[model samples]
Target: MKEDSVLKKLSRDWRVVLMVALVIFSVIAIGPHFDENGQFATNLQYGLDLQEGSWLQMEFQAEVVTVQTGQPLQEIAANLSEQLDAEVLPVGPDQIEVRMPMTEAELRPLFEQAGAEVVAVNQGVSKETAESVKRVLDEKVNSLGTKDARVNVLTGLNGITRYVRVELAGVDMETANEIVGKQGKFEIRVETTGDQTQHVLFGDSITSVSTPEKDPHYGKWGVSFTIDEAGAKAFQEAAISSNAVNDPQNHELIMYLDNETVYSAPLTVELANSLKANPVRSLTATTGTGDEGLEKAMNLEIHLRAGSLPVDVKVVGSGSVSAALGDYFKILSFLAAVLALIVVGVVIYYRYREPSIVLPMVMTTLAEILILLGIARFIQQLDLASIAGIIAVMGTGIDQLVVITDEVLHEGRVPSPSVYLKRLGRALGIIMVAASTTIIAMLPLALMDLSTLRGFAIITILGVFVGVLITRPAYGKIIMAILSK
Candidate 1:
């Protein structure tokens, strides 16, 4: 009857119900399942260290400098570009981005020649250019059909992006380099004689490239792009010179990216007649109908943009992990986490020596882990460092539970209902203070772009938050119910 009464009181408690609901929700989010080969898998994503992959850290070859110039910024930028033989553009008020690496000494003279005084020279690209580079890399990686990829821009404390890192899963260092090292160079040429072709224009002439679209009438897939006036005139001149305006079928226009042909199609009769009359600015490269056409059109869109970054880059660091080694690390990480939980449970049992108290503490701690993993599955990828953080959270969680147990059982005796409530509140106050301090300490690491350590810090901070917010209060309510019986 006492046990039944305890169960009834616990069932009525809202805290325990909330904890249970969260556990169930977490399990669903994790979505653990077995693959066809009878191997376990889940929606949880693992980092490069926990899976087969390669990583490349690349430094942008660019600089941002403040200048004082009486000449128009545009003129100075163009003159500086011509003098340095590099891409230079105005970024902000009195600031310009030179898309090449150079020391302050080398830049000062050039700025002076361009009628500008160099105030400061920073060895990194501006934030906007960095983001543009990231977008281009993202498109290139996606076009290659890589399974999982991560591109992170590492900015210094001075708010300049010096390096960008790319992580590709299920690939080697060579393959990773091939993907990120070469920037696409797009060219368009028109077929002349038997196999000879005449150059129409380079990718620089392209003004805009749009997303793939389907033709409503014919169900054909195509990518539309607009070219500059010079490009249009060049295209018209090429068509007239190659006799393509009269014999459209014989004179196929070919597109190449990185010296490899990507698209070839003859101009339609209407387009040929339009080119005969005047230069055409907008054009569509049509692929065949269906899914394959849509896929081709998508790739064509990326190719048309040339996948060119605003600034050049140099690979500074790279590494790779084989599938076998990754599997070994994954197993070790699992074992480490299990060992931590077991050791914590044993210590808790020794301290309390009572099945009721020990069981609730262990169960509560496990629940905390579940909620943490569930939340992490959505926001962060699991890695060896993050697994270490999980173990650390386990130890800290047990300590907080012990504090609660000792506080409520003051003078080695179970407290009355009124006394228990007061003690629980005080215990909660202590836990909150400790949680705040832990969060404060981990905030910098969690927020910074410190690569792997960021994961560890984030998991630690998240674990602390889950414990204080959800599991601890529930454990307090649950322990009170059992002790009252």
Candidate 2:
């Protein structure tokens, strides 16, 4: 084939190869979501570890309830703390509560352990039933869009009930506080595009929402929404208003929340219960699948986008990335990376006794860094920790590259390339163990509830593995050829 034809062929077919590789990579990156009850895909989630020190904050809210019979305030407070799995502090002798760093999932079990119930009136509960209080708490916790959060309990004044406090971290403070304010109230409003129109849609009917193509042809993205019965009624009414508008220009309804535009478009076909009849079905996986599995995910993603809370966010407590701090961190990181390169470079010189070998090691080291930065931007966000990790891996790669380089350049006097690789494999086995140990030690922390720490651990582990697996080998191979010349 002509070089142009070959290039075109590669360009044409590269997507297939990339797709397959990406699918595998995505599975490694986001597949863990499928194993969870939520069926979440981590594909789009920027792990905090990857972007550590970007922004972080924690906010606290307090929930009040009545005291039940048979428990003193102090005991009840203590009990509530245990239920919430947080430390309770006595705000007052007769009333007290607590706060802990527990996530949302840990609350109910803690409540059950405390033998307290969630009461409605915020008043006295008979000494009789602690189960109700816990059930209420459990219900509320489950209803919130989170499975992880912090909770605590306190005694109420006048023997009214327990006061509970929840602490949320790793989210913007404004949004988090708004979420707490909502108390998990599922609110939906159906409204037409204009005050003159009489159509609407409700929250319950929304089976899902999709932007389908990340970007649309019109320069404006289109979104599809599925409605349940209650939502269908509201949507139909809103559509009817659109139909009522005699002016073609007015023949559309808009969706709004808190007096702000969310979705607005012309009302076309009306559907009965099922969204498959809707014209935009082709773009939506959730609508066409008939699988309820996607419904919750769609709802969650939609609610985050359409609701008050943002699906993506800015760091809550990233008060100021001190130009001073950034400067300091950059200097240290640069020093460390340079120091590593120098050490590796010196080692290669000591081992190979030639400038040819040393030069390639330096090139391979720089190449690894470029590849790491590219991966961080496209595949994930890069933070200081991950940068540190990448630098460390680069240093490690130099040593391995030196081995492979040494092996390859000597093949004429030694064995063949494959034979040299075989000899190199023994050392690689040791390298693999070292890399594996680092990755294994990081697994638990990578899986931590602390998103930043999780990102740090994950990216670092991946960086080390990538250095050892993909980049190191290729770099070493290329470096070996150059050195042999």
Candidate 3:
């Protein structure tokens, strides 16, 4: 009869049903399993701080400058590029990006010579260039097959990105640095008569690579690139010698990055005819049609650049954590979480002096944490800062549960169901306000790339939502039933 009563109560309460469903789903998401070595494990990922890894923070050696000029924007950019021997790009109506490091003093003279005056200079790249740099870094890191790697661009409020942070797990500091620092060697080759390829030009011969774009007329995706005069001449000679101009169908152009063929396609009839006439400085490599074409075009652009960032970067900070130290930190973080829960339980017991009340509060708080971790298993990696956020969540969870308990137990007796519902609504109002405040405060940290604190802020925000939306209401329902009895 008692078991039936408990089942009936759970069935009657939607809050209980939702909470139980979430708990079961969370447990499955966590996926606790034994390894081949018969050791307990979980699907929860750990960040660099919790695993053997190295991290590097690199600053771009470039600057974004606001300029006032009477000259044409393209003319000013061209003159500046010539004078500084670096890539100069116009970012906005009055903003120009210099792709090499130069001080105000060094750039002031060049601006005057180019018929432009420097309004202000900031040590960073434009947002677009920063994204390109980030993409290049991602491709380079991923090419190494490093399973766990992250690249984050740190942008400022003014839309300038000054720094990029990279973290690689299970990699030593030396290897990590090498992987990031090394540049791929790219080459262009022409297919010979019988399954043979002859090299035309190296990556250094390429001067510029444009972003992938779709041809409006044909809707085919392709990347445009510009080669130096010598490279163009060499390419023409290779095509003519290979008889690709006369028999374009049998001959194909192959692009290689680090000796790996990244793209291979036959020359168009127009391109072959043009090559037969003269060297072409500008060339486009068509991938294909549709989304797959666009994807391939983007990859080809990366290959054409040979893993070179649009702006140079200098390592400003770097560090490593040994496997043993990471393991120790992981153990410490686990102990801290366990200790926090125990302390919360003890304090709740001291306040209520009832095992029934204290146990439910502590258990509900633990359930909130479990759900948070389970969700994080898919979207986040546990680190020292995130663990601290988990502890903070525990603290906040207990405080909110106490509010619910005290509100329901007002006048030292359970009220009627109608009054109980009203009090629960009021308690939830308080928790909503508190949760909103916390979410607001952490919003900036979560959105901004402030190193490790980003993880801290994100985990804290997730925990608050889980507590306010899921666990707290369920706790209210559970405690109401116990107090009513």
Residue-level error in angstroms, candidate 2, position 425: 4.0
Error of 2 at 424 (Å): 3.4
lDDT of model number 1: 0.89
Q: Give the range where candidate 3 is weakest over 10 consecutive residues by summed lDDT.
A: 1-10
Predictions in order: lDDT: 0.89, 0.47, 0.90
Q: In terms of TM-score, how similar is model 2 to the real structure?
A: 0.46
Off by over 4 Å in 2: 1-56, 59-196, 199-254, 258-319, 405-418, 451-455, 479-485
Q: Which has the better TM-score: candidate 1, or candidate 3?
A: 3
TM-score ranking of the models: 3, 1, 2
For model 2, how does the per-residue alpha-carbon lDDT over 385-476 read when each residue is reduced to its tens digit?
66666676676677667556555556445456576667567656767787888889889877643333555676677767666766555554
* Candidate 2 weakest ten by summed lDDT: 123-132
lDDT of 3 by residue, 1-485 (tens): 76467568867999888887888889999998999999777888889999899999999999998999887887888788887778888888999999999899988888887888899999999888888888888999999798678889988889998999999988999999998888899999999979998989999999988778899999999999989999999999999999998898888999999889999888999999999899999999999999999889878888999998878899999999999998999999999999999999998999989998998898898889889998998888888999999999999899999999999889888899999999999999999999999999999889876566989999999999898889998998888877766
Which of candidates 2 and 3 is the stronger one according to TM-score? 3
Using alpha carbons, what is the TM-score of model 3? 0.91
Candidate 1 versus the native: TM-score? 0.78
Task: Give the Å error, residue 159, model 3.
Answer: 2.2
Which numbered prediction scores highest in lDDT against the true structure?
3
User: Which digits, one per residue and each the tens of the lDDT, describe model 1 over residues 212-295?
Assistant: 789999999999988989999999999999999999999999999878899999999999999999999999999989999988
